[model samples]
Target: MNGFTRTVMRTVLQAIPTILGIIVISFLLLYLMPGDAVDAIAGMSGSASQETMDALRDTYGLNDSFIVQFFRYLGGVLTLNFGTSISYSAPVLDVIMERLPSTMILMLTAFVIALTVGIMVGWAMAVFAGKWPDRLLTSTSLLLYSAPNFWVGLMIIVIFSARLQWFPSGGAETIGAALTGWGWFLDRLKHLVLPSCALAAFFVAIYARLTRAAMLEVLRQDYIRTAAAKGLHPMLIQFRHGLRNALIPVTTVAGMHLGNMLGGAVVVETVFNWPGIGRLTMSAIAARDTQVLLGILLLTSVVVIIVNVIIDWLTTLLDPRIRS
Candidate 1:
């Protein structure tokens, strides 16, 4: 089979066990909770008779035994029915879908910024090898990686947003606002600036260090020395041979970080008040919105599984040895 087909088949095989495991875990935890969905809903509503609550439970099939509820949840999931949110009074899938686009946009932009800048800075450090630039870059990366994300976010807010008045302090956009042409685009970008920086800074640091190390190691290889001795231009040697080999390690790190960036955007999202899944999930948990919580958990697990599969495919492309 071709590479694409082989990859899809392999991912499907791997996904079976992962999906089952997620289902089992989600089912067991939610099932073991003290109250049924009806109880949660009634508690929010202030008061309801026992008969009314029991009837509601029966309507939602919460009256079923633990094993029966598990089967029902599994069956619903198979049909792509994530069920209604007890708190939101809306379908769990709808709520998630509504917030997904914003989260993806924020994460995609952050990832792009992190990867591009990190690689470029890292490449320069590698080229310089033992020079001041290398040491400076390494030190800067270590500092950023070790710094607390919330603190960095607060600093950015204070200096840039509050003091300088250069950017929005919080929220995706002003309430009841319409964007006209490029003005809207620019406004949205203004909102993204702080949060994206807060999210990408730490990742950029690690990426630069990793890329520098990988590139330096590749530079020391015999083939690299042979390329240099052949009188090939320095740029050609670095770009064609050294960079490609260095990228094998970068790709692995990038793939791992990509999945993390998607799920780990919570801090940035919360700080900036962006209307994304992270904020939504956090609120759900605090409010005891079990359906929303469950939906978010399942969605995160699925993304992780898909990312791992994609990383496996990328590994083959980066280092053809994986093809064997």
Candidate 2:
């Protein structure tokens, strides 16, 4: 009934079309991709009789007309039945659910690190504008932004894992460690550090730059000058007034980056051999597991839409003028 509630409801309603479009486009693209899933399966087994291939195609409904098959898949998706994976012999949803936790952990850890460090460094840059500190921070952030995540991941592995033996080279946890309680928690944290750093590197640069720019612009606003004239503590003016307004742009960027990371931490996950959805997606693509691929795409699309909606709501909350 309230304005905010109506806004949230309207946003959700709007997202339905986007979700449908994602499904339609992803399905059509994958459907139009060359080579049949049956053929890929057969080839994996080093050639099969023509009859066997034919039977396989028929068994998987690959022999159906394109429209018929597409509608059937769409109907299943509407019913929360993503079908079984051709390669894994498991339900697509189940397979994705199993891997989802690992990916969420990695992405969330990376997000927190990026947001915290980026905000702090950016705030520092704003505070020290036109000085050596600002110049150094700006240059460092640019370098981080330009560096590739996979390369950063590999270098971290080399230094921390191979050279220093400080952390496991790759994986969610040690293969056979009998860790429990705090021990298990610590092990997971250790395995998480390098990948998180690698994944967060580029995002840190992006957030830092955006935040610094936002802060600079915000600091020049009339209200900021008024606050300064009112004899409020300098730090209070910066943190309470300036930072609040600056966060609007940062929130938008953070939401977009979070959505992207959810869809795929492909490079970082692959480099670190983290058993996340991104690695699973790579395997599914390599094997031409259409069902699994579609499932991942759908899940990712949903996450992205949800994240953006939340960001919109947050923005409205932060700056009431956006509700207009």
Q: Pick the lDDT winner.
A: 2
Tens digit of per-residue lDDT, candidate 2, span 108-164: 899899999999899999999999999999999999888888788888999999999
Task: Write one digit per residue (lDDT tens) for candidate 1, span 187-296.
Answer: 88899888988888888898888888889899999999999899999999998898888888887788778767866688888888989998998877665666677778
CA deviation > 4 Å runs, candidate 2:
none
Tell me how many clashing residue pairs each candidate has.
Answer: 0, 0
- For candidate 1, the per-residue lDDT at 37 reads 59
Give the TM-score comparing model 1 with the true structure, all chains together. Answer: 0.89
Q: After superposition, how far is residue 119 of candidate 1 from its true place, in Å?
A: 1.6
TM-score of each: 0.89, 0.95
Model 2 per-residue lDDT at 161: 92
